[model samples]
Target: MSLLTHSRQRTAPSNTPPSRGGGRRTGRRAGAARKQFTAWLFLVPTLLVFGLFAWWPIVRSLLLGFQRTNLVDPAVWVGLDNFRALLDDPLLGTAVGNTLLFVGLGILIGFPAPLVLAAVVTTVRRGAGIYRFLVYLPVVIPPVVAILLWKWFYDPGSGLFNNALGLIGLGPFSWLESPDTAMLSLVLEATWAGMGGAVLIYLAAMAGIPAELYEAAEVDGAGIRRRIRHVMLPQLRSVIGLLLLVQLIGTIQVFTEPYVFTGGGPENATLTVLLLIFRYAFQDGEYGQAAALSFLMVLALALLSAVYLRATRSWSRS
Candidate 1:
């Protein structure tokens, strides 16, 4: 009896491999690999589409920058000559100056206006949604429609602005006719059309701010102005910085407003880099120069974004 019992206990838990356990583990690994393969298979179409459409065009543009092409003849390698020609162009300085001025005016007049509007709209108890809708309505309007409407308002002879000013004893003034006022007019239209998006973004950001922070500031005898300065602005610094960067990039690439309104008109007073690029390609038929300018602009934007991120590391998302 004792010998049989001892033999049975020893055989019950021997070191022999459990085939079922090993099979389970192998099955688990096989399932995992199949799952991974399926996931990647699904991703293949998207990757291929992006590579073909998005990435290929970018690579082609980079390559074409150093070569000359008119879509019919074989591309001829020109190796930086196009860039040099752009540098030597007399209108380059004018375009850059106009672009810089546009950016400056946007920062000063355009940026703060939306912030103020958002702040006021936030405080209103009644009809808040109506106010928000009104502010954002301009954003939904088609660009061409809005630009045409503003064109009528900017008409020097019988424009709404001139007619209104004349009633107040002011002379009818040319808003977009003169070179001096053309850039400003473009900015005015741009800011009006653009600020709605910023306002909505800010309002969304403001919604996320902790109510307790506002209450704490108020308990400390803070007025509305004080609360905004101390509590709201600090909370929004990151959003504001992000929007500033976006606006700067967009403003530098200003094309549509100037293109539609003036065609970089009144002696190229409102010409921007993008407009110049368009002219180079379509007007002058210098595709090489256009590609070169596009490449340089991309490099500049990259450098600017890097510097901006470094400088605003505290607020930026990198």
Candidate 2:
């Protein structure tokens, strides 16, 4: 060895701890920190946007629930007065009952319609793209515009539906003018406009299912119906459960179709909770009452969602 190297080795300290992989680990942690910082930096704008537009409305609604404000004057604190007003209104019960009926009908029929439609669509071999396009086309139309178009179809005189039924000797019926038929009519319109979204989602999920599974079922002598029963439905259970929850929440908030179609008319048969809130806020300018109702609706939905989630936790796992 060189005399200088030998002199350096002799003078080197013996107390330094030898690092096994400390340098590598430190580099990794620093790199991870940098990556995390970069990710947060990119996400800040989106988070801020959601906070301003989405979360802010909810926070404002809660605050306004306790105060009366019409945006033209200073807000006045009314505490529980707005809620008490809602409680005393006789129409409030009608609206709630109608809303509950809507949700129940959707659960009974609307929830399964899309699933059945998607399954049927999958079985179509010719012009599949055209079929999907047709199935999803209604959703592309603005709901207000669609409701207006449907109003013509629902006309009591010379209407398409009644005209068709007339050919079969089914007497002309007032679809929207009668209280008994009005809610059903709204439900029908809602199902037509809404089922398209669920159908598309189900189609996407169906596409992800393994073809080999179906082939195996066929090899085991499973027919089409049996295959759907044992394989398709099982694969779709989680998606179905999720859509059911969404439908229940959405049906409770049914507003636009009822508003545009009947204006909550025919003795307020189509009146729903949201329409009542709209009337309070815009028609009567009772902002406090509207906010109070909105909060109550939110609370009811939240409780329902909690119960539904608890009930379906096992369903999801399966």
Candidate 3:
């Protein structure tokens, strides 16, 4: 009888219904696993495509930087010889200096013009949309087309600029023909071409600023300039910093203007790093050197970006 009772007690526990919560928990775990599997199923193709197209090319380029190949002949392993050749090339210093000059000029002329234009447009009570449209029109225009249009405007003899200046007896200027004016001309066109997007960004940011801050400044006896200095400038500080960094990166890699307009001519005065890379790869058939130089430029830009981000990390948090 005692043995039978013990067996019955053990059997009684097994006979009890399974806890409802435990069943639900198992179902929920299965459901979560299915969802996770579905998510990964959808993500796999995108991952594969990105790896094949983007990551593969970057890896290939990195490998190419150390190899000498014309994409036809079998690649020869050159180790650091490509980099050594780049360092030995005198044109490298010229290209770097010219690129730096372009960046400096872009900062001086291109950076502030957008902010100023946005501020002026904000003052206009009517036709603000029309003003924005006009400002942004150039961005829609093809870059090559815009450069060609400016080429006509820069003509030394019968150009619009020369004609306009002739009325004031200012005489004709060699805008693209002379090395002195060539880079400045490129900068001007680039500024005009690119400022539209920046202007719109500034305008959007400005619209988000509370009017009460401006009103409080007015109440505190602040004039227009003072209000801008104290209120507006502080608000736009981060935006300004971001755009400045973007401009610096863009100008340093300038290629199209020098290539299309000057051909890095007038004694290679307008020659830039990117154009030099193009020359190395296409003109000189030194593909390895071109890749090495491009890799170096990438490293430089990465370093610059890292430094800027590190410097701004604290300021951005505040």
Candidate closest to the true structure, highest lDDT: 2
Question: Better model by lDDT, 1 or 3?
Answer: 3
TM-scores vs. true structure, each candidate: 0.91, 0.88, 0.96
Name the TM-score of candidate 2.
0.88
* Candidate with more favorable, higher TM-score: 1 or 3: 3
Question: How many clashing pairs per prediction, in order?
Answer: 0, 0, 0
For 150-219, candidate 2 gives per-residue lDDT tens digits of 9999999978999999999996889999998998888888999989999999999999999999999999
What value does the lDDT take at residue 25 in candidate 1? 92
Top-TM-score candidate index: 3
TM-score, cand. 3 vs. native: 0.96
How do the candidates rank by lDDT, highest first?
A: 2, 3, 1
lDDT of 1 by residue, 1-318 (tens): 699998998789768776798899999999999999999999999999999999998788888889889968999999999989999998988888899999998888888989999998999999999999999999999988999999999998888989999999996878887998999988999999999999999999999999999999999999999999999999899899989999999999999999999999888899998999999999998998998888899999999999998899865553
Per-residue lDDT of model 3, residues 94-187, tens digit only: 9999899899899999989999999999999999999999999999999999999999999998899999999999969999999899999999
Order of candidate numbers by TM-score, starting with the best: 3, 1, 2
Clash count, candidate 3: 0
Off by over 4 Å in 1: 1-22, 316-318
RMSD to the hidden true structure, all candidates: 3.9, 4.3, 1.5
Indicate the worst ten consecutive residues by lDDT in candidate 2: 103-112
